[model samples]
Target: MSFVESRAAIAEALSTVEGVTGYPKRPTTWTPGDAIVLVEQIDHTLGVAWQVTWRIVLLLSGDEGVAIEQLDELLPLITDALQPLVYVDTATPEAVQTEGGDMTAVVILARSE
Candidate 1:
């Protein structure tokens, strides 16, 4: 599935769980070689629905090196919040350098039922 579709599915599934109210998409910014898609979900429990955010990033192979360690920092929080219904099964980041720069990297965010 595409990154946006995967993000939406994760948010929607979380909304169906207990104390969940709704999931809304969020704005994201990145460089030309970077793409990020985010979704925010709110759950009403303890008198207020908690907000949970999920992000998927896609980076392409570029001439100059690019760093996205910041995403790694926030991943734990996302994993912790979506404990019950959503989880990130796999994350693979690679760099491919060819004669014609023929390389691309995919970042997948999966949520299970």
Candidate 2:
């Protein structure tokens, strides 16, 4: 699928997940990738948007910071959500920011995992 299509698919999938997971509904957006910043918006809660970076997609959960090991366990769940749309390269650790609120995730998908 094209970038926009892929983004849309991912976003749709995330919405379903949110509904089933009982997470608050949030607005989302996507930016076309070029030479830099190859990312697509998956979900957005508040001003914080969940994005998929090209090189790597970092995913997180819980109110407190998640450890690397814990993150590893969560990858399959994300992959399960994304695998149907397209191939997703395994997620990697990116910047984990805990500034104003609880911990969230930013998944970066290159091609497939």
Candidate 3:
């Protein structure tokens, strides 16, 4: 599939996760609760196809402690949801600060051909 089509498919796949609120193509406005943001990290041309590495960020809202706990709960679900479509590379916990408050993000690296 083309890059745009590939990304759209990834977003559609992520939409099926039970606890996820939404999968946004870009990180513009923050959603009220939990949401998934997809960012294209890198791309390599593999002859006729391109291998794209995507940063699947799970934005979690609430207290730091609770958000960390929630990351543990949600990481596997996100990975499972993406398994059939992409190769999950790594998942890491991150702390993000916004004007509103502190938030947590589980940044997952996934590769798609």
Candidate 4:
């Protein structure tokens, strides 16, 4: 699939997780609660196939402790939802300070070809 199509498919898969809001594109305004943001990280030609890497940011609005707890709860669900769609290479917790608020983000690296 093309990169755009792969991204859309990944978003669709992410939306299946309960209590998680999936964004195909970055939102102008952040959501109030838990959400997932899909970002295209890189794309390169691997032999005849094109490999696309996507950064799936799982975000929660709260302090580090609480947000980490919430993200921990959601991680398995997110991985399960993504398993059928893409190859999940890594999922790492990160502290992010956004204009909206202090947030915890689980940055997931996934790839598709």
Candidate 5:
């Protein structure tokens, strides 16, 4: 269960954050809060060697600016946590917003050196 381990690592990195829940066994039944950040399992590339990118989604209950700020706050944390691994590319803002809140998903690419 590499994905599970990866998810766990991400959770451990984000432990200090006020409210964040990594891949929950029961997402439908439980949620962190209005400002929720979920670290999804790593999506792997099917080929000779396996490389992955973690999809970290942020659902904030504030204005778009607030959401972006939170996203910014998490990036370095994530980068630091995944020490051996690294961000594949610049975070594409795909930063979408909803009523009174914002949602941003950053796909971090990585390889084991």
Candidate 6:
């Protein structure tokens, strides 16, 4: 799939989450207290048709405890919400920091199978 389509699908899935701005949007497009920003990144096509690896960066503010908790809680929730987009079951997350708050890269490999 194309990168645009991949991000659109991911954004759709993420929007289902409670309090999450799931629709693909630039961080600047959102308001304050959004809790987290789902920014699509480094997405490209897989060797196979309809398959793609999507990297979503979640920007949130908090400490390690809070960051860990968000990752733990959102991972499955994000996975489950991706209907029709097969969750790869091998994606992982990386933690980081930003001027806005804590951040993590949630790598999700999916196929619109």
- lDDT of candidate 6 over 34-103, digit per residue (tens): 3232333333456643444444555433565665676677767766877566554555565555566545
Candidates 2 and 3 compared: the better one by lDDT is: 3
Per-residue lDDT over 16-112 for candidate 3, one digit per residue giving the tens place of the 0 to 100 score: 8776754547656664345554656655586776678877777776577877777777777877887888898998877777777767777778898
Clashing pairs in 3: none
Using TM-score, give the best candidate's number: 4
| TM-score of each candidate structure, all chains considered together | 0.34, 0.45, 0.80, 0.84, 0.52, 0.61
Candidate 2's C-alpha runs over 4 A off are 18-70, 98-106
Per-residue lDDT tens digits for candidate 2, residues 22-96, read: 111222421211111235434444665444444333335433355454555655665677567656655545444
CA lDDT, every model vs. true structure: 0.45, 0.44, 0.71, 0.74, 0.47, 0.54
lDDT of 6: 0.54
Candidate 6 off by > 4 Å = 23-25, 29-50, 101-105, 111-113
Among these predicted structures, which one has the highest lDDT? 4
Q: Specify the poorest-scoring 10-residue window by lDDT in model 1.
A: 21-30
| Steric clash pairs (candidate 6) | 15-22
- Once all C-alphas are superposed, what RMSD does model 3 give against the true structure? 2.3
Error of 1 at 40 (Å): 20
Estimate candidate 2's alpha-carbon lDDT, on a 0 to 1 scale: 0.44
What is the lDDT ranking, best to worst?
A: 4, 3, 6, 5, 1, 2
Tens digit per residue, CA lDDT, model 1, 1-113: 44456556555544443333223353242232333445433344565434333444444445333334433543454456456545666556655444555344445454432
Backbone clash tally for model 4? 0
Q: Is candidate 2 or candidate 4 better by TM-score?
A: 4
